[model samples]
Target: MIRSMTGYGKGEALSEQGRCTVEIRSVNHRYGEISVRMPRAFMALENEVKKALACTLKRGKIDAYVQWEEAGGCAALPAADLVLARGYAELLRSLSQELGLKEEPSLGLILAQKGVLGEAVAGQPDPDQCLAQLMSAVQGAVAAMDAMRRREGDALLCDLASRRGQVAQWVQRISERAPQVVDEYRQKLKIRLDQLLEGTEMDAARLAQEVALMADRCDVTEELVRLSSHFTQFDDALAADEPVGRKLDFLMQEMNREINTIGSKSSDAEVTSLVIRIKAEMEKMREQVQNVE
Candidate 1:
């Protein structure tokens, strides 16, 4: 099924080590681009996260945010380096004595030194163990996002279908009006010639020749035929199972080309009006196609 390129989704997983939450946001883009943001500890999994997203969300500016909260009991405890703290205290005392300072080095000063207290390395969760939970959460978020995109796509499909049908009707109107334009022009020409000649008889063969020339000059049969073919292709694209945004966009361009040709060939007001309306509808469909995937 088709999908829109804009959506939001979130998923979470809980384990003995921690809770992992993932949120994904996507917007329309011409190409597929994915970015991931996570803690430094999980940097190794960034590629995995992007791969997972790209597998489902094929075209968009996608951003994924990952948050990890260690379980209450699993949280890493800060460990004090007693040896480093002692060394800092000794250095401070020696500097104080050398400078003839009256105040002693406080315990706070020693503990505040760099590397004195830090998170225990052993307390960190294993990345291998966390992969399963992370992937599960990723899959959930993708499913949610896909559902939203599909719903939006359905709405797009309906709107496009309605506009396509309306354009086809106008094309039909133009085709019906084309033949009358030449006949009307012939009548107007003959009347003008009669008025100028003051009752002189007109040449029937010459008049027929002139009308034939006019009809040949203003013929839009070929353009209308191509437009009909483009409409059929547009319908097929909408019913397609895969991404057809580019295909639909190309068809819109082709339709516009045919409509422009029709407008230029005819001098009739009704045909020109129909051409204008068809162009307007094509613009709307073109804009909507940019969001399809």
Candidate 2:
């Protein structure tokens, strides 16, 4: 399915760690770019988030935001108390010497003493699990954006298809009118030559050769054939799965080249008018193609 390069989506997930929210915004861009914003605590997950988004979006200027809420189960980190530990160890040593005891207090017995160390009520969330949850939210957000982009692409495709069809019609009109132009020019040339040398001996073979050369110069058969071929390729690009904006733009240029050749080869007013209209429509299609992904 085709997808536009502009869209927005949001996703949220809840887990033992916290609530994770992901928001993504995208707009048309020639290359894929993703920028992520989140808390410092989750800064380590930026690369992972970008990689995850790359799996879905091929091209765009994507801005992603991640929000996290702490769960009640997590507790603050305990502050170590060096002063208290040293005081308790010193007091223990003094009591041992006064009691004539020779054994030294173990390191564990000092830490276990009251007021020496604080205990935690709950453990902090697992870094791995938190990252996993965040990714899940980000994936959901990308999926939502994909749906919106695809919907917008449907409209774009329909418009482009209609314009392509119109261009094809104009090319056909130019092709049919091209032959008549040379025939008309041949007659005009002969009349002009007769008027220039009235009652004088005119070389019939020379006139025929002149008319033949004019016809050859004005012929648009090759250009018409190439234009039709380009139309076929344009249709294929529309049906393609990957990004085709650049491809379509290139095809439009090729089509314009053929149209220009046809216009230059023929001096017919009708052909000029049709060529002008095709150019106008092609310009509009080009503007729309810029938004395609």
Candidate 3:
């Protein structure tokens, strides 16, 4: 099944701790890679998220956004480290006594000390619960993205199939013209020989041998055969379960090689034109294959 490399999806999962929203966007790329953006709370699970994405996405530049809103807008208050604040306060009071400073160390002074104030961490959601929620949201988003990719892929495949048929027709035209090229060359050789010899008796056996050599040298049967085989392979790859982009690319290169060889060997105007036409179609298919996965 063909799949496209570009798509978008969004999903959400809710729990007692909060609501988590995950949105994913992907585009064509040579390799699989993913980046995530979310609140600091989810940073620890970035790798886990990537792994989950890789399970569904074969190749693409994926960008994900995650958002979490705590239930009821509840939050923890700033907390004080009592030991550190007490130690600092005591040292200040001692210094004040030794220096005969009139000022007494106040509660405000203790609270203002560095590291003395920090958030009273809220009860964290269970780790398992967080991971489960994350994976669920990720799966939902990826499923939606895959649906879009499949739809786009079906459309692209239709276009590619039509162009592939055109290429096949061009190949067939070249095949039909190949044998005639040799026969025409042999006939021209005989006419030229008769004119040069002023209508004298020509050696038919020698002419036949030379014509055979020309036929062998100019034959494009092998190239057409290989080209046909590649077309079959291309169709098979399209129906394959794995990503078919690279496979299609390699087959296209092989097809190019065969068509070029046919063009060089035939030396026929019509065959040459057909080769060029097939190559144009090949270029178009290449462009489309780049977006396939």
Candidate 4:
């Protein structure tokens, strides 16, 4: 079944290390693009995350957000700057001695000195464990998003099918009206000739030749046949189990081309009006195809 490019999904996984949550949002795009936002600790896994999304989602502008809530996670780990702490202790002891103070520098006092305690550079403690949890969460989120996209795709398919049928009906009407147009032209031409030749005989062979030429110029049989073939191809693509947005887009262009050709060749007002409506329907289908995958 086809899928739409717009959807949102969220998923999570838990492990002894932490709980990983992922949220994915996708929108229509001409090509595949996946962007991930996560803590600096998981930055190394950015490419892998993007690859996984692209592999499953195929085509779209996808944004993924990753959140790792450590059973006791910190934006950054608290660290004791041992070197700084030692220096502060030494300086305090020297000052106490110089002042002949009896009191020793309290551990807390030394520890609280400037830069004695600080935060460590953020980094993954266990990359393997993080990756496993992250991948699991990402997979779950992808599954959810896929389901939503499919549901939307079904709706899109119905609309496209209905429009296709409408266009086909209009094409049929145009086909039926084409012959009448030539016949009407022939009749009108004969009447004009008769009026001009008042009391004189008109050339029957010449009139038939003129009618034949007009019919040849206005024939839309081949265009209609090709358009019908495109419709079949469109249906086949829709039923296929793969990304067919580009294929459908191409087919719409082709169908539009044929319709334009027919419209240009047709002189009848009725056929022209039908062409206008078909073109309108084709435009709507093309817009809908842009959302399919």
Identify the candidate with maximal lDDT.
Answer: 4
lDDT of 4 by residue, 131-236 (tens): 8888999999999999999999999989998999899999999988989999899999999998999969888999999999999999999998999899999999
Against the true structure, what is each candidate's TM-score?
A: 0.87, 0.80, 0.81, 0.84
Using TM-score, give the best candidate's number: 1
Residue-by-residue lDDT tens digits, candidate 1, 199-276: 998998999999999999899999988988998999999999888888888888888998898889888999988988
Question: Candidate 1 — what's its lDDT?
Answer: 0.89
Cα-based lDDT for every prediction: 0.89, 0.86, 0.87, 0.90
Q: How many residue pairs clash in each candidate?
A: 0, 0, 0, 0
- Which digits, one per residue and each the tens of the lDDT, describe model 3 over residues 150-179? 999998889888999899988887888888
Please state every model's RMSD to the true fold in angstroms: 2.9, 9.1, 4.1, 4.6
Worst 10 residues of 2 by lDDT: 119-128
For model 3 the TM-score comes to 0.81
Residue 66: error of model 3 in Å? 2.1
Query: Which of 1 and 4 is ahead in TM-score?
Result: 1
Error of 3 at 271 (Å): 0.4
Q: After superposition, how far is residue 191 of candidate 2 from its true place, in Å?
A: 1.4
lDDT order of candidates, top first = 4, 1, 3, 2
Candidate 3 ranges with C-alpha deviation above 4 Å: 73-128
Which is the better candidate, 3 or 4, if ranked by TM-score? 4
